[model samples]
Target: MKLEMIGDIHLGMALNRKKADFDFNVKKRYPVISVSNIEEEGYFNNKGFEYFPSTELLSKKYFTEEGEVLMRLTHPNTAVYISKKQEDLLVPSYFVKIKITDKNYLPEYVAWYLNSEETKRELQKVQSGTRVTSTSKKVLETLVIKELSIEKQKRIVDLVELHQKEKTLYEKLIKEKEKQLAAATAEIMAD
Candidate 1:
């Protein structure tokens, strides 16, 4: 199942042809979301996002609105969904911003699908460069994904969110257990 098979992908395809302009050395007020901003569990972590030097770049041209999907252009492995109900966030050049035009499929579904192992494998096949493997715009345009009902997509997204929450709680639990173990060991050794 391919994206084109569902509907007119070109209609939904919204690639800001304008090149991302920002001076990395110059820090500014606006926060820019890079690939690193995405956490290990495929969630946004704004603790250390970079600042775009140009406020002019923040205009709809370079920023991501709600439900917009941002994928890593270099590796094409991570797809971070902009689901926050707030002002647009700037997306840097390292990532490709995708706007799903198809009403049948939700943007969240597309983001989740892009981050799936199957999609990664397919992207890897067309990626170039031995040192830093990367997929191109053409590759993204022709990418195939399993076509499913909107309801199923919603359920999948919900399950993934639940799994992420579980993973986060599990990590915290492990950390607390480790601290307890360390303190107990120290007390016993001192005795």
Candidate 2:
């Protein structure tokens, strides 16, 4: 099924405002989320975001809701599905925000598909530009997505999450082992 059939896809805030307009003194500054904040693991990295000036124009259209999927338009393009509400973060112009309109497809599942190798390969083939490669809105709309049952999507997402958690734990363990080895080497040299 085509992605447009499942949801609406549009660019994020295109306003070009200066830093002087933002209220950076307080913790409630309007945070602008960029493509750099999304990690390869399909989660928000919570880093490298800039704040925008709060204005009357900051409507519901600027913020992303739960179940919304975000895709980067620039090179190294990636997609992430928001499972929970992220307060103070507004989607920026370089990212595309997709809000699901149909119940047949899960937001997380669609995000997973977008991040998959299959989709990435497809995108790499047709993506335009030289310095800053990006997929056109029209081209992106034509992507064919596999239709899967909600139950299976949930199961797959769960399994992927589990695998990621395990991978993180293993990385931590390896770092600890390396530290221990270094300490042991130092102790032997001192003796």
Candidate 3:
């Protein structure tokens, strides 16, 4: 099965590259099996957990609601990049949508592939602009993709979902532990 590649098309240029790098570093330090970016993106809006430890369980709150929407909005084979700007400036609103013709690939698998480092570097290579290194819709449409079977695609999606559940359970456990710790400390202080 043939695969197609595409760029992220969205407004706000909301991707924080520095934060992404930091998260990536932390993930490497902890050493998890899943992609750090996916974990980070999922945990972006979550409160309390400043950084995720490798063995530290994840919570549902860490997963970004925006990410779900963004993931669904784009074609499965599309890769999205949040623009990095030098100064505090609002990025122009734009969304690029591409259609994929391949039947063997699932959208979730394709999305993961596009988000990989190797593919990101390739997309960067195609960038022509000086200041922002913008990627055009047409360029994205022509990008190459590796095709995987439907069963494999479903398995990947399942793994991602499983991680999400684990993250949620961890979050719940952590919150409970924090509450218990606080109560115990308060009781001791009262004595």
Among these predicted structures, which one has the highest TM-score?
Answer: 2
Ordered from best to worst TM-score, the candidate numbers read: 2, 1, 3
lDDT of 2 by residue, 12-110 (tens): 777564234545533345778865678876777647677676544466777878878888877666888876755546888788888878898888888
How high is each candidate's TM-score? 0.81, 0.85, 0.48
**What's the lDDT for all of these models?**
0.69, 0.78, 0.43
Best of the two (2, 3) by TM-score:
2
Task: State the lDDT at 157 in candidate 3.
Answer: 67
lDDT of 3: 0.43
lDDT of 1 by residue, 7-89 (tens): 23211122234323555533335666756678645677546766545523335556677777777867756876778642366
What TM-score would candidate 3 get against the native? 0.48
Kindly list the per-residue Cα lDDT of model 3 for residues 61-107, writing each as its tens digit.
Answer: 22332222122212222342222211112222233322333556555
- Locate the minimum summed-lDDT window of 10 residues in model 3: 81-90
* Candidates, ranked, lDDT: 2, 1, 3
Clashes of 2: 0
Off by over 4 Å in 2: 18-28, 46-49, 53-57, 85-88
- Candidate closer to the true structure by TM-score (higher is better), 1 or 2: 2
In model 2, the clashing pairs are none
